[model samples]
Target: MNTYQHDWHTSEGYDGGLHHCRKCKRSHQGPRLEAHDCPVSDAEHHAVAWLGHAGLYRTRFDAVRNFEQSVTPVSVDELFELASKQILSQINEGCQRG
Candidate 1:
């Protein structure tokens, strides 16, 4: 729920750490925190950035497909937008609480 943590891990391709932006969930490497420019200003941006990663896109697509089966189906973009808005809201709420 709390998405403030900038998740960092050792990169296999490099000696520095890889940082995952909490808002956009995009990975960054060899960049200082101050230099990293996260492009997640809204839900749409968050969805696009998050789904831009191949692994996350496939996994989220499967999950969204199942979700659609339980309710009215929507376009791929709309589905992702809805899901992204929900996630962004939760992150904001958690940030406020913390």
Candidate 2:
């Protein structure tokens, strides 16, 4: 495992903008980043780790906020389907390249 220091970046806004890591995609919902543990490596983990809800911390910070604020109707089933399809596409592409 390769532990990495967080490179925290803040969004441009006045409302105590979010601070998120550019590497592991961990996010904090405030202007200041508090202490937290990031993933040890950049390697991908099991899909179960982030295959369900859109609120997963691994998601981009801005995406989470936008999703929360949007009134559009989105179902978890659809999210899962979209995510799975993308994942399968990536895997197939990688396999073909290899």
Candidate 3:
């Protein structure tokens, strides 16, 4: 497990405006940063970890771990679909209320 420290990254040499965070991949509007100046969400970290932990051809099938059977394998496209559904539903609800 790699622990991220604030001092590890800082954009000290370049003129800063908006730099995409290398850690979270979010566009952060701030001074040029060598280290990521944006806050990382637990969900984002977990997602990245899960994606990196699995490969395209390999799936986790270990049975010795706790709650292994409860895990479901989902593709990145599927995740986008789920988020799109949630967002559309919220938009619809807002539209109906007005």
Best by lDDT: 2
Q: TM-scores for all candidates? A: 0.28, 0.32, 0.31
The C-alpha RMSD of each candidate to the native structure, in angstroms, is 15.1, 13.6, 13.7
List, residue by residue over 32-54, the lDDT tens digit for candidate 3: 44552546433434441122232
Query: In candidate 3, which residue ranges exceed 4 Å CA deviation?
Result: 1-69
The CA lDDT of each predicted structure is 0.51, 0.56, 0.47
- Candidate 2 lDDT tens digits, 1-98: 44656668887555787787876777777667554456633333222223224444333344455564422223456568868988999999999999
Candidate 1 residue-wise lDDT, 1-98, digit = tens: 22233434444445455666655666777753654354434443334322332223334356465453322224468667768998999999999999
Candidate 2: which stretches are off by over 4 Å?
1-4, 41-98
**Residue 3 error, candidate 2, Å:** 5.7
TM-score, cand. 3 vs. native: 0.31
Q: Tell me how far the alpha carbon of residue 21 in candidate 2 is from the true structure, in angstroms, after superposition.
A: 0.6
Q: What's the CA error at residue 50 for candidate 1, in Å?
A: 22
